[model samples]
Target: MKAVKWFAPHDMRLVEVPKPAPKPHEALIRIESTGVCGSDMHYYTDGRIGKTIITEPLILGHEYAGIVESVGADANPALVGKRVAVEPGIPCLKCEHCLRGRYNVCTTLQFPGGPPYDGALAEYSAVHAAFCFPVPDAITAAEAAMIEPLAVALHTIELAHLMPGETVAILGLGPIGLLTAQVARLAGAGRILGTDLLGYRVDVAKRYGVDAAYNAQTIDSVETILRETNGRGVDLAIDCARSTLTPAIACRVARPAGRCILTGISGEEYGQFPVDIARRKELTITWCRRFRFNFQTAIDLVASGRIDVRSLITHSFPLEQSRDAFELVSRAGENVLKTSVDQ
Candidate 1:
């Protein structure tokens, strides 16, 4: 088998490796496609995201889809020969967080591609059968690889508690941000705005059905959005960029009694916030983590053509060229919304 391994920062290599056999209660999936995520780029370029450093060689993919080739003796035979979306995080079901339906925050969660565990950027991977969700025949493997990010988008909209006919502003036009914009529209948001520093991304957002897309570096985002909304501000603001000024900007551009959803991870421990503004406006703040139980919904949306995940997938590479794919994502190259490695 072949695998993409990140030995260290700026040091990923495609090496021949042994095929992994499924353990009891597990299934071995032959990976078809694996999406390169923002966190994957962060780990590739800097070797870490905040305190979670990659101190050892690790497989660098979690947004993946594949076909089940074999199942362990203890695994359900029904899972074999199914096309599935791989859920990368496995939590300790006994934890308080898990019990509360917040398993993404489980204290003992082991997330693939983050640190200690190997991930799905391989010809074949063995994962717990419970985490694998069968994909309908209507969705292609490339589309299924993106279900992970779409799941994040779905989770973000759920966190914001967006109401039908309400307006929304998504701050960032990256893969997750743009996907969130589309999901918000699907969720019945009346108006959707997406912002990014890149003009290409802004243009892409518009093509993806965003009502408006703004270049934050060239325009006063808050003012432009306010003017467009007749000075009432948006009813909801979702920050998909981990900018230091995003939270305050979100507050400034949102209406009183509006909601703000933060989906991106920041390098800094504490970001500056306009507490006074939030207090005066009575804004609701919501935080998002990796998706929880949203994959099936994402699959449903993709299968039904309600959410077009294909528009977000702009680049694909063979597993042997995985380094090039990572470089393109890390550098934010042109037309590269999401890069997937095909095994």
Candidate 2:
């Protein structure tokens, strides 16, 4: 088996390794495609996010799809040959959070390509059967690989409690932001606006049917949004860029009583905010965690044609070119939306 391993900052190697064996409740899958995520790029460039440092060599991919090659003795034989999109995180079922259906907050969660567990960056991966949802025949492996990110988007929108006919302003146009825009539209948001520094990303959002797109770096986002919304501001603002300036701007661009959902990954020791301004406007703010049981919903959305993630894949590299794939995603420019590694 071949895998992409991260040993240190900006250091990754594609090396041969032994294939994994599935446990009694798990399935051994022959991975077909894996997507390089923003978190993976963070680990590749900085060796860590916050205090979670990469002290040991680790496989670095989580967004993936595969075919079941073998199942545990206790597992159903019918699972064999089934194509699946892996959920990537396995929380301890014994935890209260897990029992309460909030497993995304489980204290002892094992998340692939995260702090400790290896991810699905190899030819084969052993995942819990329950965490691997069967990909419908209509969904291609490339689209299946995007289900992970789509789940993140779905979870964020759910957290926001978005309502029909609401307007939203997204402060990023990466995969997460682009997917969130589509999900918001599906949730019946009246007007979906997306912003990014890259022209290509804005173009991508436009292709996805966004009502408006902006270049945050070239234009004044808050001013433009206010004008577009007739000075009432948007009903919701989602900061998916993890940019320090984004959250503050979100507060400014949001309506007086609107909600702001911060879905980006930020490890800042302290987030400086315009407390007085937010308090004056009485804005509601929420932070998004990974996801809770949204994988199946994400797959169904794509399978039913409500979400089109197939266009999100802008680059693909075979297992032998895994290094190149990682680099392309790590240095994603205007042209790259998502990059995948294929087996």
User: Per-candidate TM vs. native?
Assistant: 0.96, 0.96
Expressed as tens digits, the lDDT of each residue in 261-327 for candidate 1 is 9887665567889999999999998889889999999999899998888878889999989989998
Worst 10 residues of 2 by lDDT: 265-274
Candidate 2 lDDT score at position 270: 57
Model 1 poorest ten-residue lDDT run: 262-271
lDDT of 2 by residue, 126-172 (tens): 98888889988888887899999999999999988999999999998
Candidate 1 residue runs with Cα over 4 Å from true position: none
Clash number for each model: 0, 0
lDDT of each: 0.88, 0.87
CA lDDT of 44 in candidate 1? 86
Pairs of residues at least 3 apart in sequence or in different chains that clash in candidate 2: none
RMSD over all Cα atoms, model 1: 1.4
